[model samples]
Target: MISEFRSFIAKGNVVDLAVGIIIGGAFTGIVNSLVNDVVMPFVGVIVGGIDFSNYFLPLTSAVTADTLEAARAQGAVFAYGKFITVIINFLILAWIIFLMVKGVNRIRAMEEKKPAEASPAPPPADVQLLTEIRDLLKTRA
Candidate 1:
């Protein structure tokens, strides 16, 4: 059982999965930063400087809350902005991953498309015939 477990852990797929997970985590951070720091700011500027993360409504008409927290405190069913934020982040992450994978596949396809270099021709036909004749003569002797 221990040997089986060790073998499983040592498998190429396992190592690949581990590496992928680590890289994915790092990529997640990058995507998050891109969404929060770069994309969201631009989106806000284009949309009249309104913060998407702050756009929400208070469910309770009597209890008007200025912020999401205030709305939540007043028991309002708010959009929470976090949901949309996460959606945008996920879209961005997926797009980046798709592009990277596409680029890698393109490179792999190019490599595969290249014809293999031809090896040097074998010994001349006359040489082969002579060798065969010499072998036959020796066998007869």
Candidate 2:
């Protein structure tokens, strides 16, 4: 059973999946940083410096706090700005993955289109030598 488990774990597909998961986790952090630190700042500058993180709707009259965190502490609040940021992050990540898959598919297609190596030609025939050898063998027999 342990040997079977080891074999399953050692399979190429399993290892590849594990590697992909690890890389995806790291990539998520990079995308999040790109959205929050880089993209959002530029967007804010373009839109007159309005911070989207603070944009929310108060569900209750008691939720009058300016920040989402403060509003949440006071009462129920709908945090749409955070949702918007998350949507942007998802779009960026999806686009990157799509481009990567497209590139891989293109490379695979190019490889498939390449012509196979030609097989070597057979050696030239020697009819006279073959006949002489057959005659000599017949005489011996």
Candidate 3:
């Protein structure tokens, strides 16, 4: 059973999956940073400098707070602004993945479009025998 487990871990697919998971985690962090640090700032500027992260509605009158964090601390709050930011992040990440898949597909299409190299046809058996006989005769001469 241990040997089976070892073999399973040793398989190329498992290794590839592990590598992909690690890369995906790293890529997620990059995407999150791009959304939060870079993109959101520009978006905020365009949308009258209203910070989306702070946008929230307190569920209860007692939970009156200006910011999402403060509202959450007070009571349950509907954090729609944070949701919007997350939605935007998802959209950007999805768009990037779509572009990457499209590029790979385009490359695959180009490869498929290339004409295959045609191999030269072999001479007929009679012609081959005649050629061999001629070579023998030439050697004798």
Candidate 4:
């Protein structure tokens, strides 16, 4: 059972999955930073200086706090702005992945389109003659 487990863990797919998970975690952080730091700021500026993450509806009358965090601290709050931001992040990430896949597919298509290397041209006439002479000598022997 232990050997079976070891073999399973050592499979190519398992290793690939592990690598993918690690890379995906890192990519998520980068995408989050891109959304939070870069994209959101620009979006805010374009739509007037309003922080989207701070926008939320208070579900409880007790929650009068303006910011989403403070509102959540006070009582139940519907944080739709955060949801919107997350949706944007997902869209961006999806588009990027789609583009990467497209590029890879295009490269693969190009490679497929390329003709296989032609067989080496027939040996030069003199080389062919030498080969015939050698074969004749072998036959004679």
Candidate order, lDDT descending = 4, 3, 2, 1
TM-score of each candidate?
A: 0.78, 0.76, 0.76, 0.81
* Model 1: lDDT to the true structure: 0.87
Give the per-residue lDDT digits (tens) of candidate 3, residues 1-141: 999999999999999999999999999999999999999999999989978999888888889778787888899888999999999999999999999999999999999999988888999999999999999999999
User: Any residue pairs clashing in model 4, and if so which?
Assistant: none
User: Could you tell me which residue pairs clash in candidate 3?
Assistant: none
lDDT per residue for candidate 4 within 60-81, as digits (tens), equals: 8999998888899999999999
Clash pairs for candidate 1: none
What number of clashing residue pairs does each candidate have, in the order they appear? 0, 0, 0, 0
lDDT of 2 by residue, 1-141 (tens): 999999999999999999999999999999999999999998899999978899999998988798999999999888999998999899999999999999999999999999988887754578667888899999999
Root-mean-square deviation (CA) per prediction: 3.4, 5.0, 5.5, 3.9
Q: What is the lDDT of residue 95 in candidate 1?
A: 89
Model 4, backbone clash pairs (residues 3+ apart or across chains), number: 0
Candidate 2 error regions (>4 Å): 117-119, 125-141
